[model samples]
Target: MSVDHATMSGLLAGLRVVDLSRNLPGPFCTRMLADLGASIIKVEPPEGDPSRPLGPLFDALNHGKESRRIDFRQPTDLDQLREWLVDADIMVDSFRPGILQSMGLDFDRLKAINPKLVMVSITGYGQHGAWSQRAGHDLNFMAMSGALDQMRAPTGELAMSNVQWGDMAGGSSMACIAILAGIFDAQRRGTGRHIDISMAHGAHAHLVLPKATATLFAPVLGHPPGAGEDMLNGNLPCYNLYATADGRHLAVGAFEFKFWKAACAVFERPDWVERHWQRGQAPGSPENNALRDDVAALIATQPLAYWAERFEPADACVTPVLTMHEAQAHPLFADAARTQPWAAI
Candidate 1:
């Protein structure tokens, strides 16, 4: 049977999500749920969501969701919020541990009104931690979780990435997954569960690469080498970033042996094909460093456009580093860039 994906009933079509969280994480989670056809009601304070001033980001995250302004301190507004919660399937909040309870919106109280209500609390630490009440942002969480430690440059200096790994990937992404799990559990068990998402802990969970390679390097090794230390971290010539003649950058991620062989062939360095990671050459060794330098110099001989054209039809992993504007205009993301409002069920 043929099915139309756009016209089909969405996975979360019957779900109702009430977002009390502000800023990025909670709002982003609800936005994703809204995309999956869930009805999202974003309850804001009298002054509105703190992220409202962020312009494009606010519009992107809060679109297709209904907004209500309420003062939690006011009895009338609290009563109105209580009414809204009675029918909500999921509730997301980012307040500190006791803040919601202080506002008389505790899990137990809300469950008494509606037992199947899935409550998700997103925080910097967690519900039962000493740092639960501490205020922290994306960089703070990444720093606390050792994620920032792994982003060192070649000279052992820590590099700052513009992407919000902790806030968006760790916090928001985990919260989304947990909320869906909560929804499934509520539907099957007829009882909702409280989801506690700590942004720092979530970021820590994403430190998988370091943990996987822990045995390779001793803990006594004071500051572990970050860049150019491991195959995935830019040690190998075939899987690193290179600069073009025009000062533009190219990311060559030919990690597998076959792909690396293909890339070597494309670069007219057929002799380098045998120098794979498992070829008994230790990562970041003199030989590997020499190879990396050779690749960099070779790439720099040509402009970005030249390499882009050469690698376009080739199966080898090579791509030009693009700015945000360029990425948005790319044909691959053309469909995704047209952010439509959540379709009606």
Candidate 2:
């Protein structure tokens, strides 16, 4: 892909960022900063960032920035890095705790060199914790945080996700938000602060919403429904995926009464409307499974395109389950695709 650096513009136009991170999370965070017009100087090790060999993804994340390959382990290289940090506004790294400190790039050391530098350290656990020293990745973090348990399939196997929740949402997104906040705080206080980000902690934080609901319903429900046994996880007829006659799937998000009623009307199954969440009709219950089977059978009578057209004017929350290619080609994403951060790259 061709990069048009001039097209990058944002509020952080004059901000200077020194990226000492590699792989997905740190690079993703720095990319966001670069997109917002920060002057990102991506300092690569002598061997270069690992993502450099990842082809299109490398261009997608590291484009629109200045890259310098330096081996900080060498004395002269370390001196050069110190030069880069002397006036840098922000510094981000993804090494485990104490690693950077050993390299003399710790917060206090960097702060002494540049008082206004916002230093962000992204890790798997945190700076000081029992699990901080352990090695982990996105799957490990998600699994340890119980998020993976909630994503189990009908056969009790964990479903692989298309996106890395721990890396992207937990590490990258959290780091981006903290870096921005750190920048504000540094300017206001005339000093910078160290931002410690734990990918596992961030992943666990996302469980707040559904966890609260599960806690609230636990006493009455015996236990919150287990994975695919829950309403929102495909056990309920109103909120699930259905296979069409053409072997394509459709997503049904009619959890609310109005939408569920509309869907029932469309299926000529008005009797199933009021049966929603009735006694003995809890998700995965015999009654619920029977209703799900009935609904699935009805859905299988028509092809995906037929259902798509039939529900076009209906208020039912029904839509086709599109493939990634189809989604990118769809009109709904035309504007987003055109304005995406990687568009110019």
Candidate 3:
């Protein structure tokens, strides 16, 4: 679990970043940059970041970064912030579209101060749109992007995800990519770029595969799959979740013919090998539903441990569903301390 920070410390050794963001998205983005050896100066409000009260989360996001208190309401403090931006390689913020302009920190003014500064503006929506100035959080962005609709339970009830997909994936991750690309381009062209990242737009972009499948089969299926009706979701017996006798779950991801065949062999249901999607078994069809029911019934007869042991040597993609704590303790995550240095502290 030991990381050679000396080797990683020079990745972005000379980079200077001014982080004017609070809470999750902006802080997470800068945290990643800091991990890659960028010097991050976290510009907090006079009262500090709102997330500071969250304890561990704040520490996890702001570790290894310098902190500076700046009151934008004060002209002198704003001037000091501008001075810092003059030599900063990157600047990140999460204000609404016109908020920074009102505070005299707009991209145009900053560009004049430092033409080579890469400015990243992360928001719920883009810089210009009807919802650009709207107040929203992760759930609102996911709902707007149709991402939430796809996360539904077997009973057709919408399930809320524990992870902040919009904030972390759409906003933070996309902003990091945009920042790196902008830095590369600025280094080449000798001019910085203002990158506008919309969490909703980025979330929508992640649905490319599902969107394509829906479009490709909408004409034949009359409508897109709903809830547990999709092939990859829960329609096929070969690729689905089954409850064990102990009430635990097993994730069966035997999508391909080879894996499905191997899983069928493990279940002693060799006859079910050919009843697969690749062999013309239409997902969610009556035959597939019957096969899924049979498989589920069989799986329910055994405990999760039995299946886990059975599948340990099987080539099938079957795996026992472990709780978060169990996953953390698993050997797969044994080196987590190396990547999450703050966890060790």
Scored by lDDT, model 2 comes in at: 0.85
Clashes of each: 0, 0, 0
- Among the numbered candidates, top lDDT falls to 3
Q: What is the C-alpha lDDT of each candidate?
A: 0.85, 0.85, 0.91
**What ranking of all candidate models by lDDT puts the best one first?**
3, 1, 2
All candidates: CA RMSD (Å): 3.0, 4.0, 3.0
TM-score of 2: 0.89
What TM-score would you give candidate 1 relative to the actual structure?
0.93
Better of 1 and 3 by lDDT: 3
> How far out, in Å, is residue 313 in model 1?
1.0
The order of the candidates by TM-score, greatest first, is: 3, 1, 2
Put down candidate 2 lDDT per residue, 1-345, tens digits, no spaces: 665545755657989999999988998888888887889999999888998898888888898889998987887888899899998998899898998888888888888889998888999999997899999999998988778788887667889897899988889999999999999998899999999999999898888756876875677578886765655777788889999999999898998878988988888887898867743356656888898889999999999999888888899998899899898787877644455554446
Cα RMSD for predicted model 3: 3.0
lDDT of 1 at 308: 88
